[model samples]
Target chain A: MINRRDFMKLSAVGGGAVFLSGLSQITQAAAAYDDFYFVQLSDSHWGYQGPANPEANNTLRKAVETVNGLELQPDFIMFTGDLTHTTDDPKERRKRLTEFRDIVSDLKVKNVHFIPGEHDASLDNGAAFKEFFGETHYSFDHKGVHFVTLDNVSDPGASIGEAQLAWLAADLAKQARDARIVVFTHRPLFDLVPKWDWATRDGAKVVQILMEYPNVTVFYGHIHQENHHMTGHIAHHSAKSLVFPLPAPGSQDKRTPLPWNPAAPFSGLGFREVEAEDKPFQLKITEFPVTRA
Target chain B: MDLQISKGWKIGTACLAILALVSIGAAHSAAPKTGKERVVKVVAKRFIYTPNEIILKAGVPARLEFTSLDFVHGFKVPDLDIRVDLPPGKVTTVHLTPQKAGVYDFLCDNFCGVGHEEMSGKIIVKD
Candidate 1:
């Protein structure tokens, strides 16, 4: 049974015929399993100190508290990337990563997942990040959904690299064509706005590999804004940042963070809740502000 | 619709395009030798650029030659619509004439190590 919310999401992604035909089959599979949801928090930039976010030090802590305050806690929490600000000093980078890990460890949900953003990994090729977080990229299964975390930022050139692409292809080859796949990465796979460094250089190859699958959704956080795009039938969504918000793509000459508003604290800074329903095979995203206005 | 008018139109368009191309080549070959053109060499490595600050006179053409000593870096001046890729051990040249007198910020858009965000400089164009 398609709900109004599901209908809206489907229509938003050009729901004409291809997606709807598979909906009935997905709805039939709903009887055997229950729906699950996860929280997507990205670009926290924990060690960042700037005028863009006057309350940067306190925002991540407050976000953890806010998530804990939720009525229905998520099954897992995935931090898409940018856990800490980039630092030239390796020691400082590790220190910030350690602090970021400790702060987020306070979250209520124990099954938390993490990936590296450019700020977190590009410096030493994700070496420091691997010390805190186990691996830069990995895949797992949850409630019939295949979740693949990609390491696009570890390379200074913002590429997924040829080796990782082979691994991804081999991994996807094992799954059925209709498998529901969710990809998490720090950078957007498609070239949204290359001038602002919002694009992954080899993202097109990633998109091409996923095009074989019928059900795939990509969630990424680099632009620090909520954006949605479709590469054929696949949908790619960008998450907002916990530290600061960037202006819309191509809206300005520079991709500078929006000025902080004194009257409106924590404006444009928010997180997301993604509910994955198996019956209709839909991922519903609800954006929440870091703090109540 | 007549043959004579059609032929005349094509000939007229061809003559005008040739004239435009010749004039454009002349302007390109003549402008740089006027003695006002300045050449600035910049070296990029790790997270900083050498001689980060550059000054130029408005309306004077300048050539900015960029080279990367380490990783590949991008020299982007968004306001001036200049974006150049400086590969390691390669020299890339960009020429521009600032029509306006103002301070323009340029940065290494490419991610070079950890302090990529701090790799920035300003181009000061004086009136």
Candidate 2:
């Protein structure tokens, strides 16, 4: 439901006509567009076997079931990263990636997107990840919004690199100042926490380029918990991990995964759906649990 | 409220404190000791490490003294199970004895700057 604040924001950006129009007219105007929503599932960490998540083998399958159960299936589903756990053996890594791919293929929405997390790409410089998921970075247009995916994890040092930066700059050059742009990345563009390996090495440069556009939102997942922050006017949102939860940034000395509580299974594992409508770009984010309570 | 301690109680408390201190000292002394210490001073900048290739004798303890010239950096030898955080303007030291002779790659695990990905080194442990 659009509250008073949301209405004011919509009216302000919708121009003077929207301001003069009655509330009923505004509702009609909002419904008169091809709005779309997409699902985001991140850090599945498939093939991970540990005490932190006793049901690691089944979590990803259950998440697929949950998404399939959505009353309204998203237009597309995006996996932010960590499709598979890190493995020293290249063959094992590919095996895990194949298993993860097979599990996610059951999604009702065949149109899916993916990016790499450090666990999936860093060891072999994205060779295995690329083999399975095509290019590490690319852009696509859906409905009235533009979506760009950046690879920050392929490089072990957690950098987006100069080449990708130039590509992003050129990509943005074609769009209008107020164009609705959405960025999907595994690591946050802004430095959330460097010590814990939470921030991207060259993330500031990427953020600088993104700051040029007025309407841009970055959706990322690596911290394994939900976090929201803003750099200038750009909003950065991180999603929860399907494997296990981590403590808040800098809350403890070590960034260890929070131990699984037998009483509350799958407490911090889930995915989210983000709905967007243009005209005056507005977003509605709804989070869904991987399993019902 | 008036509280008083008897001489016997005071003596017992003093004895417990002394025992605890002695135990702690013994534990400290039992910790691993660097044998035939070999100091290797390394410097870190934006995305490079000075003397990136290091050579050490297997079974000989080496003290790695790391200093970051610019931002905070990290030294992580994943296979060797060694990780250290080097804050700028400070000396962070790590000690290890290479029991096996092999080439172990080490990288700056911390995100320094733009060129951080290329910041890596190797330790050649000679038999």
Candidate 3:
């Protein structure tokens, strides 16, 4: 059953007919499903040093602490992208990645999935990301849900491209129409704002492939703010960055990082928890602030 | 005899004037200001460069003043060996004179983020 809090949150975000339909399906499938949960951490931006986030160093540590403290253990953890701040030197990049890996290794969950943010993959065109995280784009199945992680950021031009698109099409062909699909990528597939560099160059093509599926949800990072959008029946949700926040689209003249306030540490930064159930298929998302203001 | 001498003098004077004018023309052609240094203000953010596409006359000198709106970014035009490191909130200037008319690609050599590789622009030099 849909709770009032979930309804309020969904309504506030303009969760349209598709979301409502999904909710109804979940309600009907309640008896046939087993519950499981996962955590999503995005834009940790490790190795980032600046006043924008005074606690930048501790940001990932704090997220780890929070995840460990969860009363209900998460089945896994997925980091959306922007794992590091980015550096030109190869040695430095490796160092940052190693440090980030070491820190996140402490996570209680063993099944952790990582996708490269532009900062991590754009420099060497996914070489570093692949070296460290294995495949840049791949799929996995967990509890009846098919999760597809794509490498959009590695292209430098921010495109899923032909090969990856073909892979996606072929991969989707194997799944039944009733299968629940969750897509993960670094950038928004639709144009959020071209001027602000929020839109992926060839994202429309990727969307076309995803449209064939009835139950498809896309989660992405890069905008560094919690946002929701819809294309056809598909719902797109952008998670908040673990490090710091950026200005809302066109909120300012420029898409600069939001200045941090010393008075309020880790105010607008946090991670998301997603609870999923089988049978009718239900996924409920909850966002937690790092520090309560 | 007097008329012939005057004619010769007149010709010599005219030749000297012609030489003076030719030298001045040569000097003007040699120092023709291609166009006042084309100054462009570029703001570098996470993974993209603003004013990414730059157009300049072939012979014109260009000055790009780059300021990072976000992180530290490196502006590099390898063809011209023009590179500048842009630190947040600081303006870095790069000077270039396009000697040839061609399209030159510039990119952020410093990795800014996931989009850094795609963070590039074209410098179109027109004759």
Q: After best superposition, candidate 2 residue A221: deviation in angstroms?
A: 0.5
Best by DockQ: 1
- Assess every candidate by TM-score: 0.75, 0.67, 0.68
What C-alpha lDDT, on a 0 to 100 scale, does residue B126 get in candidate 1? 90
Q: What is the lDDT of residue A36 in candidate 2?
A: 75
* Chain A TM-score across all models, in listed order: 0.90, 0.88, 0.89
Q: Please compute DockQ, using alpha carbons, for every candidate against the native two-chain complex.
A: 0.25, 0.08, 0.10
lDDT of 3 by residue, A1-293 (tens): 86434443653243211222242233333123356767788999999988889889898898888777765568889999989888888888999999999999999898999999888888688888788889999999876678999888887567678999999999999987656788999899997865456777678999998888778888888898888888988878888898889989768545668899788778778878776745446666777765422
Worst 10 residues of 3 chain A by lDDT: A15-24
TM-score of the second chain of model 3 compared to its true counterpart: 0.69
In Å, residue B84's CA in model 3 sits off its true spot by 22
**CAPRI-style docking class of model 2 based on DockQ:** incorrect
Q: Pick the candidate with the highest lDDT.
A: 1
RMSD (CA, Å), candidate 2 to true, equals 16.7
Give the Cα error of residue B14 in candidate 3, in Å. 62
Query: Which has the better lDDT: candidate 1, or candidate 2?
Result: 1
Prediction-by-prediction clash tally? 1, 0, 8
Interface RMSD of each: 3.4, 9.8, 7.3
Off by over 4 Å in 3: A1-33, A278-280, A291-293, B1-127
Q: What local lDDT score does residue B114 receive in model 1, on the 0 to 100 scale?
A: 51
Instruction: List per-prediction Cα lDDT, in the order shown.
Output: 0.77, 0.75, 0.72
Error of 1 at A2 (Å): 19
